[model samples]
Target chain A: MELQQLDRYAKALIKEAGRKIRHSLTYELVIESKADANDLVTNMDKEIEQFFIEHIRKDYVGHAILGEEGFGDDLLSLNGYVWMLDPIDGTMNFIHQQRNFAISLGIFKDGIGVFGYIYDVMNDELYSAQKGHGAYLNDEPIPVLESTTISKAIIGMNASWVVPNRHIENEGLIRLVKDVRGIRSYGSAALELAYVSTGRIDAYMSMRLSPWDVAGGVVIAEEVGAVATNLKGQPLKFLGQDTFIVARKSLHDSLLANYITLK
Target chain B: MELQQLDRYAKALIKEAGRKIRHSLTYELVIESKADANDLVTNMDKEIEQFFIEHIRKDYVGHAILGEEGFGDDLLSLNGYVWMLDPIDGTMNFIHQQRNFAISLGIFKDGIGVFGYIYDVMNDELYSAQKGHGAYLNDEPIPVLESTTISKAIIGMNASWVVPNRHIENEGLIRLVKDVRGIRSYGSAALELAYVSTGRIDAYMSMRLSPWDVAGGVVIAEEVGAVATNLKGQPLKFLGQDTFIVARKSLHDSLLANYITLK
Candidate 1:
């Protein structure tokens, strides 16, 4: 399928998945555990993932689906058209707050991202892209970002990165926090990436994030002149967890070169 | 001035202030500083405050305006019909992100809160209340909260409270974080308080918040049966900083008794 066709379908699938999630907004949702209860897995998460998989199978039978919930195709190679989906990207946010979650999807053909979508379901925002057609919020055509310094940039990141913890030195993250223009943590990676695409946040960083957690956002983010990379300044993997930073091109080198060190 | 009249004026003024902010958002805003270069302030903050002050001075000349940016009246007490305003609450969010900030205003009559208004300009959401009449989003009357258990609640808070460095033990907050259903940090006090009032968040707590930050939110929060209190489970001082938690009365009590300890 053409990239634009994929984007159209992905956008539709995202909105449909959003409506399903929104229907559960007032329900007594069934909450469960995936990694742990703290790492929430709600019924809505499974339902939405299943919704995407069901639709993609019927509509694009040739496309392969990879999802966080164990409901999609298992693959060794991205040799064909593959769709990575994280139906409820912020399940904890969804379970607890009933908001701040998104429906995320990315379509790659032969390992090249051709389309992406992240919908802030409660807010009714849909961030969509068709590769080189550039990213968009709803219908507005968003353009590539211009330059801005780190001191003038508002960063979206959790403070957990800065304090003494697992991924990096707490002091390093704390100092980084003090150096930025402002810091915000929404606890929703898809929404934060969408915000970066929309210029609401200049950059975002997390000590560790998975492929499904950021694939759609990664595709959307690059369309806006931002860089998403591991702490070691290598390209982000589309298959595993890594310490990642999705930052402005201007600040990426400095953040990688000066601050980040392996634990 | 009559308390009812003040309520009416505050509602109108807040909506108008939201209008000015909405208009200003169309342009690229210049963000600067108030505390350090890192902490942001903006022209929109000044403009929004000036807009409210100009209207209040014309309508109720003697009513003192207590505000964040030093643009309002110098006052010892909220003795008269005092208009407490954070022209743009979450000024950092406003200056940098442009989405999470809000116009927060509260009218107190002889030390009793007569009315409160928090207008989310970008979202066009207005949360308002007059004493005894009930709180509202847009114009629909909001009901006092239904009870929710700790395991099912979503708490709104900044990580500063959860970390061990400043005041509390990291483990205490982590315990709270783990006990509660989920965590969210939206970066705006007024908005979060409004969320509490609307039942979007079961609770909101923070260690460092000034009077201007929670004054408007406290009023709205109170009307919806979300108890607003200091860490000691007492009424918050209207002058200095304190640990603030606005939650369903039951949840608020449970949090103070079970989770929070200043030491």
Candidate 2:
């Protein structure tokens, strides 16, 4: 199928999935923890992933699927038409606040992303981008990122990163927080990247994130002239969890060179 | 006038002021720095404060007004009917993202808070409370805050507080951030307090805020059984800038005793 047709199909499927997730809020969610107590997963997360997987399998037989809830294929490589999905990006937010969470998805052809979508279910905002076609927010075209200095930049990051952590040294991150215009934490990697795409925030960083957490956001942000990389200034491999940072080109370079120091 | 009647009047006036502020967004804002570069004041802030002052003077004679833009009254004491207004809380957010800012207002009679209103212009959400009448959000009654332990709490605070700052030592605050489930910074004191009142967040803290910034939020939060006090566990004087913290009773007491340490 053509990329445009695929984009249309993905958007429609995602909206339908959002409706299901919204309806589930009325019922009691079966919650579980993975890795740690703070890392949560709900029944809705699994249900949403299964919903997308079933639809994709029937509609497009050859495509591969990699999803967060263990309902999709376990692929060793991204060498075909593959879908990377995080059914619910911020599970803790969904469980606590019932908001600030999203459904993030990205489609790649042989390891190159072609289409991305991040749907903020509570707000009904759909951020989408098709490679070389430009990014959009609910039918409106998103403008490209403008240049900003580090001192004037508003950064989105988890507060834990500024404290002592294993992934990166806290001293440099603390200094960066003091130097920036301001800092915000929304507890969702995908939503923060969507904010970067819209210029609501200049940059977003995380000590660790999986492929599904950032795949959709990376595409949307890159469409608007933003750069995405691991803390070491290397491109994402999309194979596992890694440190993440996405920002406008100038600010991204400045952060890597002066502010970020990996442990 | 009856407290309920005064509440209705305040609501109507606040909505009208919100309309004017929203309209001004289309025009180029006349911005000025106050105290420092980060402290900003815009034409809309002044215009909105003046708008409220004019209406209050005509409608409620002998009532004093304390507003952020300095267009209101200079009072020696809170002995009579008084209105505390912050025309635009989160001026930096307003100038940058054009959202997440709010118009905050509180009414007091003989030094006791009688009514409070916070109008989130962009989202059209109005959080209001009348003393002994309960709190509300857009006509829906807000429930009282539930108990949450420090380990399960999600806090709203500026990032600066965790770093080296004059108001509080960083060690205890850093430990608090690690112990909490999550942290968020919205950059708007009124909106953050509204979130706490609605139980969207467990607590909100600030290093320094003026009376106008916390007056409206304090009343609304207190209506829902949340405690509002300075960092040292004293009642807010509403006279000048001071450290602020608001939360459910248990969390508030625990935070003051265990987590907070002043410089």
Taking chain B only, the TM-score of every model is 0.91, 0.93
Q: Which pairs of residues clash in candidate 1, taking residues 3 or more apart in a chain or in different chains?
A: A162-A170, A163-A170
lDDT per residue as tens, model 1, A1-263: 56557667777778777776666553434343323433333666787788888888998988898898879887888878889888888776665457788888888888877787888888898887777778888888877887788778777777556456667766555556656776777878888999888777888888878777788888888988889888888987576668888887888888777667667
Report the CAPRI category for model 2.
medium
Distance from true position, residue B195, model 1, in Å?
2.2
In the order shown, the chain A TM-scores of the predictions are: 0.91, 0.94
Residue-level lDDT of model 2, residues B135-169, one tens digit each, is 99998999888788999999998778888888899
Best by lDDT: 2
Point out where model 2 deviates above 4 Å: A26-41, B26-41
Model 1 chain A: ten consecutive residues of lowest lDDT: A32-41
Q: After superposition, how far is residue B103 of candidate 1 from its true place, in Å?
A: 0.8
> How high is the TM-score of chain B in model 2?
0.93
Considering summed lDDT, which 10 consecutive residues are worst modelled in model 2 chain B? B32-41
Candidate 1 chain B has its poorest 10 consecutive residues by lDDT at B31-40
How do the residues B147-182 of candidate 1 rate in per-residue lDDT, one tens digit apiece? 988998888877656555565556666677767766
